[model samples]
Target chain A: MEMKFPMKKFIFYKRRTANFVMLSLSLLAALITIVPLVFIFYYTISKGISNLNIDFFTKLPTPVGETGGGMVNAIVGTIILIAIGGGIGIPVGIMSGTYLSEFGKNKFGILVRFFTDVLSGIPSIVVGVVAYTLVVIPMKHFSALAGGIALAILMIPTITRTTEEMIKLVPQSYREAGLALGIPKWKITVMIVLKTAWKGIATGILLGLSRAAGETAPLLFTSLGNRFWSTDIFQPIASLTVYIYQYSTAPFKDWNDQAWTAALALILLISVLSLVFRIITRSKYKA
Target chain B: MVVNEQVNITTEKTKSPHIAGSSLKISVKELSVFFGKTKVLSDININIFERKVLAIIGPSGCGKSTFLRSLNRMNEEVGGNFTGKIIFDDEDIMKLDPVYLRRRIGMVFQKPNPFPTMSIANNVVAGLRMNGFRDKKKLKEIVETSLRQAALWDEVKDILHESGANISGGQQQRLCIARTIAMQPEVILMDEPASALDPISTAKIEELIFELKKKYTIIIVTHNMQQASRVSDYTAFFYMGKLIEMDKTIKIFTDPELKQTEDYISGRFG
Candidate 1:
């Protein structure tokens, strides 16, 4: 009896230990996926913080070997590109998303969803090539407009997918409540569904914006680069990603420092945008 | 009880054409609803009179809510095939534009679903705004009156500009009631309006229903037999997609003509 009691207790301890081991392993796997993002943030901030200064944002980019310019031109170019790209992308993406969520249970909606998925998975380089053939070649020059169009193409799929998913999350009860009150179907979609899913949709657009902001590959063949400040949308303009890429590869310490600074600025801008969006969504939830 | 009195008045009026003939706000005939190949609700006939409360009582899946939804053509939004005639205020509701028909017959849901982003005043006046009402003064008046009618005026008057979602769940449900009233709809369909609320809130809603009967025709669907007994003048018992028995509330509960209704009321079966 004493031996049997000890044996049972030992088995219980062994089972508990095995369970804890399995739990820890699963947790480690999760952490493995999250650790890279942490590393990226740590690496970028530590490397770039010393070079961050007002001059990095207020002055123009220096030539290959020179040292006294900033990323002022790149900053302006990024803003212009994002604004025009968003302008081109938001309306079309929102409409398609609405179609998929509200009217897409049929064959046509399925077809649209299939194409959207395909568009979303296409390589950014492929988009650059397409934009080169369509906008840059047609205009007979490298231009900010071509870059914006390429970014817009990248943005559409993200926006559409997010919008569709967000709209789908809205409870059917809300739609039924609106319809029961005699509201028109289109009115329900706009006033009720859109309003209910606005935060999610906004977050989706921000995600698309962030993706476009960080892209260096697409603008490589399209926007090229400019040394001086340029406001013309139809002409080539320097952006932060392109500036970072160009300066980081050059053989000068100052140019390399400026690249780090530009990268830091880009990171800070996207983080602030995401933080503001999170606050808005959080307040909505509390309300 | 109020239910017995209302039934007597309804039957007497229907026979003599003196009391309820002019008050018949909605007349439904041979209504059937199908979701895809499966029929959800069979033929239902009901006459809703003005300034009276009609309660639809049944177990789950008895088509009570389905029948209630048919009043405002809410079923149309569910992608179902509906066959029947619903006449409201001398117009065939099916023949009328759904938007226009919905304007005249408002509905409240089981759950409190105030638009989270809108203010209390905005929620009350959503229907009016949808129909292009823009005058601030007129809107203010309607909002106040509707709130009063919903018995939510005092609780919400001080914070009308606060977000609708900032209020309590019960208050949100009352806000929905105010919203429907602001439309000035002739008929109001409520689908278990108090089901999600606490008992106190349910009582308040029941009291409000009594008050609302003075101005609008009310049709309510509920699983609570006591609630049907307390507020309604007429009771309709639905079973398995068909309306089994409809009579004065007291008679339906105490002296039901159908065994199924008797069994349901006695709690022997749902």
Candidate 2:
């Protein structure tokens, strides 16, 4: 095929067409990825916003067939479990991470790293089973402690890996400077390395907590879900995910509707937590 | 301790011509450094004088920084291991606690690395606090004195509470120097300390080095031959982990005995 126009103009037109086609394809890919996420938000808001009320935050659940039910206990219970999980997991994860990045040339560091990797790759439900065996069976009953432990186990691997990576981002010169000043190694690790990497570490902690908060299967095997309000941690407790799991599967129309609202509540809780972390990280004294 | 000092004085007077006039602060004996399995500095013997500026000039990768770091045992942090003895003012280097040794032989790195989380004032006195100096008045005094010594107090005194990273690169490097000096070290080692700065900052750092040598024994490593000639009383030329020539700075620049040293000085090749 011979072109009447100059070859330079023909090449330029072809190049422009190719650019347009590739750009459109990339935009279409982004659209396809975002559409599902948008649909999820739209579906949840449409189904659950009408069900949301002041009562939803304040009141306890009604019996299975009853109409006036709220997830106040489940919400409160979720907070307690997350608090417990984070309390145990954060310190362990951070210390292990410190070992990996700072003193990790040895065999023990490699062993710890391998175990953390394996733990993170393990299924969430398998962790639930381990928690069930270690805590639930030993106590002869399901308890909130067991549920908290399960979530903590799942959180450790993510927090450890992220902390290690974040600490690595701190320059090697900072450590050298501290050492040259005759500061103790432990003091340098805690004061210099940890402080410099704290913001990144906090992000890792938040991600781990958010991931644990939405987990259902881990809580299912350990806490075993309670319909009524319970305050004692030694006793079985209701959680948002467990409540949603149960309520969504129930035959009653009102119960299924409550699941939608419960999911929306969980999403809101994670979002608020993330927003709080973001603000704290971006504050004036960020260093 | 008194007898040991007398013996060091006699040995310093008789055996070493290069360090005859000035009293010795540190003596290196057959020191060799290795990073993992690879040797970086080998079979080195040198005498560093008290209250004098010594410069180590070499091309990149010649292990100048490694030799400087070994004086304070800072090389251990970077996977470099060494064999042999370093004597600091008559005490064997291996016997002295590393943490304590570093307090008396502080170091300044090539890059300006201030603790990001600390204020300028806090960065200066970090070492003092680590050694159990808790008096706020004393800490304030040390910060002022050290910052003045580094020629940074006038620029940073008003904003002592600001983050260390908030300062300019030159200021940050001076802040690192002030931080090291606040420890009250007897000797200061600088590893190409002005390599990352602009020419003006480099000049300022060189001036600071001249001022610093009156109170502290200083060992500096430099890539720029002019810098070595300007600020150093003694110059040691290293090539490929070996000290090729060691002499007075003027003699090394004007009348180096080795051909390699002459070539490097004349810009024939690195």
Candidate 3:
């Protein structure tokens, strides 16, 4: 018996409608997520553009009611803190990641991974409290060094996780190819596996840096805040996030305006660093 | 049919004692592989002579490639339990350091998987450098010679500094072969080296295999019977994890001793 043409036509129409609905829903979800990012950029530039100038970068923070103070101290402090934090974090993170991916098939490795995951989930405020006890109280003062250590602790788990994931993404075939050539296992991991995943590892490092750049709660109790330029890492240092937090709650109107400018500066710095890292990594594969 | 008759005559003549007394380079005895309690291959016994090409032919899941991998301890990477005695140059390979053993017996995989990050010349000399050869001049010589031997030097000579991935598919396979040969291994194991290539590239590989057999002992696992007949001196037919028959290549193709061998060669089953 031959089927009627109208029945076949109806079936085709139903399938096409189902596909259209799925595509439309996906598009809607994508737009919904992008809306917040667009708004954040628009608000930041519009509110902070008038005050963006060299003076805002070069001058120091003033008294609560005065204007014309720049964020030079905060900028320098942020640089020193990040440098110290990354110095402590990157090596340990890379080693831990290598241990987890290369030797983690055993019981000890499992414990290390468990601890790292736990550390990653701990709140920034908790890290601040811990740093206050371990570093601030023992040293008898709030110092930039203490804040850097706290941020390093936060950065380690992120770098380790990213490095482990990148290492795992390297194909086993590359390792076999290296081994078959009589290369030692360590050389294969370092020269072949690591080189292949270098881009991913870079991405991971940038992500960790971006995360550490905006942290405020940990620095509040450890580094506290400074009103003038301070190069000594052992002394209390001002950072952009902490400055914004401190100024936004003050009684003076000018301090609040300066807080908005500091916030804008931090956002710009992070975005530029991320963009540069991305460009550098992408160029590696382009050639 | 006429070609078969001529091949049979030549094979019978070559089976005489005078031709069968060549020196053995590799010998496997009671070699079996098990993947976590599941036995994949039974006892595999074979003697591979120097400067000869031996082809392993079988259906899928027949453990031919498994046997080939065991010769160089390539199976060690699979994380399985294996019991075997593979002797290369009178030394038990399983008892030796796998890294050292692999240096003497290199392998080429089915797919052409060159290191994506390295230049063509670097890929060729990677094995040499890995084994602690630091002399730049000598490394360059080996790279050039190996690529020339693999028939890739003329095409890639000018662009030796280019990424290996920039080459065509056939050239990449030859580059892999060149990389393996650069190790100066005495024995080379190929796991369906030509299966992924086009007809022209397949012919080039076959010709290269023939030329290479003069300097190295080769054991190849191939699904293409024509390739086995064209290139091999000895052929081993495997079925269901057991070796069914092994003889001179012509005998395996023309007048196999077992019914199953004849059925397989005739394309009745795999």
Candidate 4:
């Protein structure tokens, strides 16, 4: 006996319709996710572009009622603060990270890892208060050094965790190859394993630096903001984020406009940092 | 040399099962390996001849690789424990510093693992550079000679500074061989060196082995029976963590004393 069954036609048409509906939904969700970012960029550029000029970059702030001025000191101050922070943070972070990945298989290592995770979760304002008591109170004054210390503390946990994870991404076979060649364990970690993970480590550094650049609460109680030109580490320093905070709250319309321009400058600085790093660490093997 | 004295002493005590002109290079006695609670290789004894190829052939999970790694203490890297006396140049290798010992006896792994971060020329000289050999001219000479010996110089000379990984699989394996050769070790241990390569590449590696033994004592672990017979002067058969039989390659293939060896060679069972 022969058996017969019904075969549904246009089943492919149904699948195609379902696929189109799902694709459209995902595209809509992705566009919704970018709405806030697009709005921020739109407002920042439109309000800030009119106020941007040579004087906005080169000249010092004027007294009340006088409008034409720049944030040169603030720009230089941010650079110095970052340099100081990175000077303290990069080596400490990389070394500790190396220890965690290469030799941190014991209880002490687990404790250190836990503490770093907790440290990264601590509020930025809390770090500012800690720096206030540790550096500002002891020195009897707020200074650029205090701000730099706060930023360094914030940078360490991010850099350390990223470096450890990046180093772990290197294949175990590479370490074996180095050991089989009679190279010492330390040499292999530094020369081969660390070098192999360098691009990722650099990305971590950039992330930490970018976070430090945008921080205002940490700089509030530490550096305490400056109005005059100063390069001294022991003296108070100005930063763009601090200026944005102060000017945005001021009654004057010009200061409020300048705040938007300062935000634009901050964004540009971070962009330049990322571009420089991308060039420096670009792979030569890309075909 | 200390090696000459040890060879004379070993030849006097051991029966003459070696090739006519070859002398002992490495002698293993009471060797066993364990990983935690599991035993990998049982007590084994074998003699490796100077400048001669010895192939350790066995099926999967037969502890042939365990025996090869034990020669240079690379087993220690993976937390393997061993109980044995491996005499190299009259020195008990277990008592020697592993770093210094490994320099005298280098190894090539089953896969081609050139350092991806380094260029071809740099990969060839990584061991020397890391050991603080800074002579530029001599380093260049070693780069050329080592690549030539590994049969890769002609293929890669034009792109010496290219990344070590940006090459064909066979070229990369040959590059790893060149890297091991650059160290100028007295002995070379290969753990299934050509198993990861294509047929033509495997044949090229076999030819390189023939040329290499004249300058270094070679011990190779292989699963291919024909490869063992074609490239090795002597062969050792391993099964269930024990050495079942060992003899001249031709004799082992033609008329092995053990039935297991005959059974495996005839494709009866692994």
Q: In angstroms, how far off is A80's CA in candidate 1?
A: 1.2
TM-score of each: 0.90, 0.93, 0.91, 0.94
Q: List candidate 2 segments past 4 Å from native.
A: A1-8, A279-287, B1-21
Please give the lDDT score at residue A75 for candidate 3.
86
The DockQ for candidate 4, computed on C-alphas, is: 0.59
User: In order, how many clashes per candidate?
Assistant: 0, 0, 0, 0
Tens digit of lDDT per residue, candidate 2, span B144-227? 999999999999989999999999999999999999989989999998899999999999999999999989999999998999
Q: Give the poorly placed runs of model 3, Cα more than 4 Å off.
A: A1-5, A8-26, A279-287, B1-21
**TM-score of chain A, all candidates:** 0.90, 0.93, 0.92, 0.93
Clashing pairs in 2: none
Clashing pairs for predicted structure model 3, backbone only: none
- Of the pair 1 and 4, which is ahead by TM-score? 4
lDDT of candidate 1 over A1-287, digit per residue (tens): 35644555688899999999999999999999999989878877887887777877788766666667677888889888887788898888888999999999999999999999999999999999999999989899999999999999999999998999999998887787677666777888998888889888988988998999888888998888788899899899889999889878988787777777778888887887678767765543322
B37-136 per-residue lDDT for model 3 (tens digits): 8888887767677788999999999998888878777776777557867777778886789888889889988888788878898899987776678999
Backbone clash pairs for candidate 4 read none
Per-residue error at B5 for model 2, in Å?
11
Model 1 residue runs over 4 Å out of place are A1-7, A23-43, A46-50, A275-287, B1-22
